[model samples]
Target: MKVLKFLSVLVVFAIIGFSYWIYSSLNAPHAHSKTNQYIQIPQGSSTGQILVKLAAEGILSSPLPLKVYLKITGSGNEMQAGEYLFDSPITPLEVLGELNNGRLRTVKLTIPEGFTRFDIAKRIAKQFPQNPPEGENAVLNLMEDISLIKDIAPEAKNLEGYMYPNTYDFQRTVTTRAILEKMVGEFKKIWKPEYADRALQLKMTPHKIITIASLIETESRLDEERAIVASVIYNRLSKGMPLGIDQTAVYIAKMENRWDGIIHKSDLESNSPYNTRKIVGLPPGPISSISESSIKAALYPATTNYIYYVLNVEKNDKSHRFYSTAAEFERGKAAYQAWLKKERR
Candidate 1:
């Protein structure tokens, strides 16, 4: 009977000791001094890898105890992959909790309005460096997956302008293709049912509407000006006149992979359907990402007789001076050229 009592007491003491050890380890501060620097945890990393990483970073004095605790709590398989930051020394339990909850480190990526897919590809390439990081061209090639919008844009050569412009929180683990998919998904959500009906009224397909929206987006930054710009495009199209948007020249230059910042005379002279200055109607596809305002402008254009517009140089706000006659447009063009020369000098 005495032996049995002693054994029970011994077991109780052992349990108390184990509990104290765990509590101490969990509440103890780590050795990390670099508060600003984040620890990048790659995807598919195991608990063993995590522990080793923590020990190497001086985040843990002993990895064995944490590993044991994680296994005991069934959290060994729950460590999420992401960039993690420990602002101050934290307990192993806290770190484990963070990992289990999956507070992934993310970067705020804003794809600004009027950005082309080429521009987006550059930004994606810069953000994500794979084992060796993909180049700009590689990223561009990934964007060639046009199946995302096939039903909407049956004639889309590639995902040139369908990647919607918006701010995104991208996880480090997210692939370049994943980002492109998300952007296009965002575009799909914004495309309302009424937009199709409106397109029907305008005798335009959804793809053509997107094409017009891209033109409006590239033509001017002003929300108020988008409708007027859309009207000018419509009026020109009705009259069998060239769209004359210089941004289309930039798009063609990018397509031919010869864009060098300056719009070369050869670029303007190129006879591609994308070169709207030479093409008599809408481009074969969108030139840049379309925003909601630009889309709305394309669908609900204001009625106007104005067939020409030039930058309002005196205002310098990217505002335009609209004209219905060729002579009026010529006067604006000369003034714009003079201002351009003065600025260049």
Candidate 2:
């Protein structure tokens, strides 16, 4: 009996020691030289394989502790595959948690509001260039495939205004097509059933609404000014007056691959249908990507007789002065031109 009791006491002490070691291994922070290194675990890698790979990469001090913990906790199958960035002085348990949660590293791409397709293509090419190093034109060609938005906008020539402008995270190996698809998908999500009904009420197609939204987006950054700008656009359209937005001229220059950052006199005189100075209605399609606020403004414009607007130089805030008559518009235009000349000097 005495021998048996001694043996039981030894076993108890052994268990306590083993538990303490496991606890220390799992919970103790380990400092590694490889900080901020992105480690990718390919698809279908087993839990054991992941642990070994992480151990080799110094993310794990030793794989045995995590392996034992997983076995004990029956969590060995919870490990997921993805690109991971492990910080220095990380605990094994924390590493396991990250792997289990699939917190994959991603590349952040931001498409600002009012970014034209040309701007988008250039940005994408710079950030996520293809293996053979395709230029912006090649990326732009990818956008020409309009099949992604066929149902929502059958008349759309390309995915210009359809690519929702927002910051998005994608895998490092993300294809340009996949990125474009994701953006168009986000746009579809915001294009609600009620919006379609509203379009019907206004006797405008989705394409037309997006075009108006794009114009409004480029014209104003203020939420208050968007509806007012929409009113100006609508009022002008009703009176058969030319939209005369200079951004359209800029868009024309861009399409011809000659946007020189300065709108030349020749640009304003261009016969391109996109030149709102020459065209009576909305552009053939959206010149830039639309934002939600701009879309809302287009759907519900403020009731006003204002048919013209010029930059409000008095406020110095990027706001505009609206006018109902040619005389009022000319006076506002003169003030704006004066301000522009002063700023240039």
Q: Among these predicted structures, which one has the highest TM-score? A: 1
Candidate 1 lDDT at 157 equals 82
Residue pairs whose backbone atoms clash in candidate 1: 130-133
Error of 1 at 99 (Å): 2.8
lDDT tens digits, residues 1-345, model 1? 999999999999999998788778887877577568788778888889988997788777788778777667875887887777775778787777777777777877789988888888888878777623488888887777789998788888888778888999987668877888999999999999899898999899999999999999999899998999999999999999998999999988887778889998888888898887787988888989989999999999889999999999999998999999999999999999999999999
What would you estimate as the lDDT of candidate 2?
Answer: 0.91
Model 1 misplacement above 4 A: 1-25, 33-49, 64-82, 131-133
The global C-alpha lDDT for each of the candidates, from Candidate 1 onward, is 0.87, 0.91
Prediction-by-prediction clash tally: 1, 0
